[model samples]
Target chain A: MSDPADPEAAPLSATHPDQPRDFVAPGADRDFAGERLTVDPAGARALLDARLIAAHAAGDTARLVTLYAEAGDSSEAAGDAAAAAFYRTHAYVFALQSGDSRAEELHRWLLREGREE
Target chain B: MTVTDSDLAAVSAPVEQARGLPNACYTDPAHFAREADAVFFASWAGLAFAADAPEPGDVKPVRFLGQPLLLARDREGVLRVFLNVCRHRGMILVEEAARLPRAIRCPYHSWCYELDGRLRTTPHVGGPGTNRHAAIDRAQLGLVEVRSHVWMGVVWVNLDGKAPEFETYAADLRARWAAFDRPLAFAPDGAFELEVACNWKLAVENYCESYHLPWVHPGLNSYSRLEDHYNIEAPGTHSGQGTRAYRPMLAEDGRRFPVIAGLDAQWEEGAEYVALYPNVLLGVHKDHAFAILLCPQGPERTVERIAIGYFDTAVLGEDWAPMRARNAAMWKEVFEEDIFVVEGMQKGRHAGGFDGGRFSPVMDSPTHCFHAWVAERLRQPA
Candidate 1:
């Protein structure tokens, strides 16, 4: 099992072999890049995106799925069709890993030619 | 089973010859107060669903017979009814329907009570002792309990403190429909609450007869003929009619709920609609059952709280949103169709020339049975 805190950890396999080694790992330190950047909307978005990338690299599939779904919603809200489609694909992968048939069905419907923007 | 001479004399004068309970009985302020004491408060009136108070510490507040009543499932999982008012200062203890509070605290003075209606704490009252009296016993200051019984998922409370045992009163109904005693779940979409501008009895009367099915409910008449319906009357106890052509809701695979053991094929086609004495009306079909509690807001206004419970709770978790919407639409249509008749009867009762109208003997026996029951109750000395 991969350590969720280690960004360089191995990707999760199809079979859930055992519980994660660092299942009860200690909390990490919080660091701010800049005072002005902390409050800026664009900075907050980039920070969230970086966190998702870290979560995905650490093999946190549940968090990855939720982040992807949130990203898809934001992209659709901002009229970014290509970005929305990419995030939706990521969400579909995570949903499959999470064993959610309902989400998988919705993802299948969204991937159809007529549904794509 | 014998009618006394007084009982015979009371009912011997035909409904036409005898003056019906006056318009005041349906629409006056003082009369409403009197009926609250004589009828509504005296009898075991249906108040809430048993499922509403399913677990220990589950408490639901209801306004019944113009008084706030709290229905609670105690530590032993026994349902108990109590006046919602605090014993200390008469403040309402619980105002909401669903709460699992460790203690019911009065918002006014913080007098706390246990889930079982025992007074738990009267903070600072006895300690300071500057003005407190020794007669103030916390044990005796428990919330006033009202007599309550749960049958077929309905919670009935007798507010007068003394009434016949619920089992004795409802024994005939129990024997008549004994097979429907399985675990039932409320159908989220099939249940509704309706406010009608009519007396509560008027709603009961309208439900007792099937003569208006063709004219009022054309959709139902298309499926069930008038001849296929029959009145079920247990003399002075309860009255309802049953239909033989009930079609069950089909699953996506056309499967129906398994019928109870010992029930014949006739029960599959059978649907019993019963008005349990004063306020509750229940409709039991093979696949589903629904009940309505006709709560009297005033003489001319009644709130009909209706709920449709299913045979299986698991079915509700399966495609619930769509199935609920479908059932809601169907019930909304049928109940909407009943509004005109109930409201019209209320208006008709006010006419100077109108006597308590005649019964068709064959077609109107159900309604006559209901009228006779009401007349007997009214004639009894309170």
Candidate 2:
């Protein structure tokens, strides 16, 4: 398996190889400019936790989809199937609600992992 | 039922011979419980206004008749009703009025549901972070939807789901008022509520006739006299009084609200107010209309909510604010004046010797009409 915390680890569709592979990379702690920050993966997750709270408080469903999906990808790269499924479930729900097209991708990922029916 | 069979027989008698509902029907909790099941649950009852959940994603939780119910407008803008309890642990879902950008997330366990009541996900039903479980069938568990129908801004619910469709049930009332069925624009400031210490039925009885107008609403009687009104009774459906002397409120600048287009000559100077049995009271005029939803808080308390709307959408503009405020205030004062009478009647119910009083055959037919309707509903086989 690839290094879980490596910035170039596989894309979120690695579990379902038939899907698009140009998606955002899992476990990649990068800033908004696509520059990899030197922050530890745990530190990066804590930052996401704060961002998630702000996003929810603002009722920003679009941002919620992106953040939860990124959290799921990071968990997936770490081989934490349960955590990955949990975050992906949220991503799927928010995406479905906001009419975001990414819901299709998140649902397929959850289905491939045997987490969603 | 706390009401005696003999008491109901007198209430069900002809208008000339009938007496009002028994005192126990209003003063006894056990009778209120029976009335809740027979009159409210078994028939279509007004629960809230569609305006309460006007936007898509708007959710309003209502505690009605001891049942926690939720009113939600789905993503498609269709309003729906559900038992507010969660399908998992029976927790209350939406605790207050809110506009959800996405799904309804249960605060206790993070169970998510789509805006249309589909159970979307259970966060960790199978153990730490695992969502799926063989025992939890998402398909079998959506919010319990109550049968609801929206008409003329009022959201009517059939709690027991045994009543006929709203259109069929209200056909007589609908056909009678078909002329004013054009687009109705709600007044931006024409909503107010009053809490009175009286049984909900008293409010309905009071609103049914013009007989009390000269004494209770002298201001309204100054222009719309009692002689200018006539009885409106559709027996098992609705009953009230219609005034042939309705005059619209005028602004300080002599401007009056725009008249409804294509009205018949009869409505040019006329208006009608009817108690839509069970809980909704409505009044329609040439230029404006109002709906009053009577919410029974307890056997001895009721909440009366009133909202007015206009025939022209221009009334919703900022320039119309002052005129709208004046209109709302006029109705508010008249409704407030009736508070003493209803509360007085409620106190009268505790008089152990009062035999429900007698109806003035000429002037009290509308009130008697309502009493007969209640009696017939209660007499239905349980």
Candidate 3:
């Protein structure tokens, strides 16, 4: 199955059209203005997944809410509807688990947007 | 009771005429306890740097004013301050300084707390009639939170729970450094910590003026002249000295660290050493940054932790150990020269006749400002 959420599937820079772009790991130092830089998709995804898994294993709903929200944003930005939906569900569950009103509102917004589509 | 204008005027008068707070203020254990309540506990005190606990779940345990404090970043990446005691059986939660944990577990009872200070487990304390124990109100029992704020990478905590808002207390510093916010990074090479055998305030006083630089730090005085130094007095709150000559620790090719986005090349010629109210001292130069946190251990003892962080993380990848070593050497030379003066002042405070030694009305404004702040806080009703 071709995953649209693959980081390599998208151009490094959407805003900077003229810049020659490249991907660099988190700790690498490259000229930000001269080149388009995209974080390694697998590594970024792994970080998000690991944080969520750890939070879930630890029963840390607050952490899960934050990680799921970040993952959902990345997935949506990459145009991966399925992955985005999955992350949104986790965000909703973690939001309810945390009893955070702001997270609850975010969950509602995600659901409303999903229903509208 | 509020301190009157006359009271302030009296305290701010030339140190000689002012009749400094009794010798007890610096020596007596009873007075130190009072200060814990009046100053360290009541007002905002700088605790640790934000960089120490940058990521979510990062935690740093600190001891300040005889209280164990846990500085942690929550799962949401929000920095939170809590007493380092477990809710169950009152054991110290974290003993080391490092990144955040999956849970803060008590060593004695294995009771766990979430990074946000929520009680997550009581560990087999719930069975039969114990499931709803009246003695343990889980809802009301979370980590005791201390009001905390971050500015310029320094974390300031209000222990009394009644301090004025952080914005209000640090308004002066925020306004002063508002321009160079983006490019400012803690220079890992320039940062340092020291243990001074004197009251923390004495260290602040020594740093607030350049009167001793010529005689004490002759190496620094070679390029940074005493006359080129200026006093930064944020009346009754914070004070420090500024210097004009700030040389960057350059790489092998003479390349300097990346400057902040909008700063001019002349920033090196415009260095500022700001003492953030109680303890933190920051030296912001165009090429690098250095900060020190002076923690008071006792009336006669203090530990000053200094860190020289850089604006560019890329510098760490370079053969920059030499730069770190040189910067540390230079600061060590300068601070070592300060020991005598601080220790001298501590010992002088014990004299029966030395009623707050004289201050040079011209060059001592910064020290006067610090004295004024100490006097003001000391006079406030506890």
Which candidate number would show the highest lDDT if scored against the true structure?
A: 2
Residue B207 alpha-carbon offset, candidate 3, angstroms: 0.4
Q: DockQ of each candidate's interface versus the true one? A: 0.01, 0.37, 0.02
Which order, best to worst by lDDT? 2, 3, 1
lDDT of each residue in B137-204, candidate 1, tens digit only: 77688999999888777898888877789988888888877777667787546567889999898888
**Candidate 2: residue B1 lDDT (0-100):** 33
The digit string of per-residue lDDT tens for model 3 on B1-382 reads 2334465567667655663444556676777777787778887888988877878878888888899999989878999999999877788888887664356766675555678988654433443112124466666778989999876677889998898898998788777766555444555555667787788888888888888888888877667898988888888567888877776656677866665556765474778887777787877766567778888999889998887666666556547667667767877777888999889888987786654566777777787788778777877866
Q: Of the true contacts between chains A and B, what fraction does model 2 have? A: 0.46
- The CA lDDT of each predicted structure is 0.69, 0.85, 0.69
Model 1: how far residue B344 lies from native, Å: 1.1
Candidates in order, TM-scores: namely 0.71, 0.89, 0.71
TM-score of chain A of each: 0.55, 0.73, 0.59
> Each candidate: RMSD to true structure?
16.5, 4.5, 14.1
Per TM-score, the best of the predicted structures is 2
Q: List the residue pairs that clash in candidate 2.
A: none
Ranking by DockQ: 2, 3, 1
Residue A61 accuracy (lDDT) in model 3: 65
